[model samples]
Target: MASITGSSISSSFKLNQALNRVCCLKTPSISFKGISLSSSRLNQATRRLSITCAAKPETVNKVCDIVKKQLALSADTAVCGESKFAALGADSLDTVEIVMGLEEEFGISVEEDSAQNIATVQDAADLIEDLISKNA
Candidate 1:
């Protein structure tokens, strides 16, 4: 999508089609056939704007473990970074316990205000990393 402002019409058309596929089909696959990227400032700006900061795999795994344990989920249950606490049958007290477990495991303290903002495993992982880095 960063090359959306490319110099080729075919590229733009393909990007538009890919965007439609993502929006309509709810798929992560995007095809960039015949896309010619131009070395333009606008394209560079678009690239910067689209950049995302994802959680580290180890951090996500640890968070997943804590979340699964707190929720008492079985080994067969699939818990990923995207798994939300509420969706995993965790209430407010359960979320607090999960946060406590994360804090103890990571040796990082999470603020009450910050704890309230965590919903998904990725959120908890990101916060743990942030807190650990800040403390270090």
Candidate 2:
């Protein structure tokens, strides 16, 4: 009977440790029966969790660079977030090649529908961020 109780305590401790690792971002306490476990310790093990992948500044810059390189645009030309590929003289073939370049650079496959929707530099950056987060 004593050994069984000891084993149960050990298992509970292990379970609490695992929970702490998963829920370390939030300071939430979980209660099991009458025992409470707090995951607010600064020294506890934690895993990073990214819920959303929004377009970051660096992603926008990289996308702009890719677009400029793919289209062979002049260095004097500016590619802003709202700058549409079509406005930048990108034809259907150019657009396809640009999408392929993005895929190769980011190591993520872009769906046909999603590829068609990428009009502006911001759109490509946002899609790339989402794909990267999903892959992560």
TM-score per candidate = 0.62, 0.60
How far residue 81's Cα lies from its native spot in candidate 1, in Å, is 1.0
Q: Could you give candidate 1's per-residue lDDT for residues 14-124 as a string of tens digits?
A: 565444323212224332444443335434543443344366778888888888888898986667655667767899999999999998898988999999999878789
lDDT of all predictions, in order shown? 0.70, 0.71
Least accurate 10 contiguous residues by lDDT in model 1: 20-29
RMSD of each: 10.6, 18.4
What is the lDDT, from 0 to 100, of the residue 131 in candidate 2? 91
- Where does model 2 exceed 4 Å of error? 1-53
lDDT of 1: 0.70
lDDT at 35 for candidate 1? 46
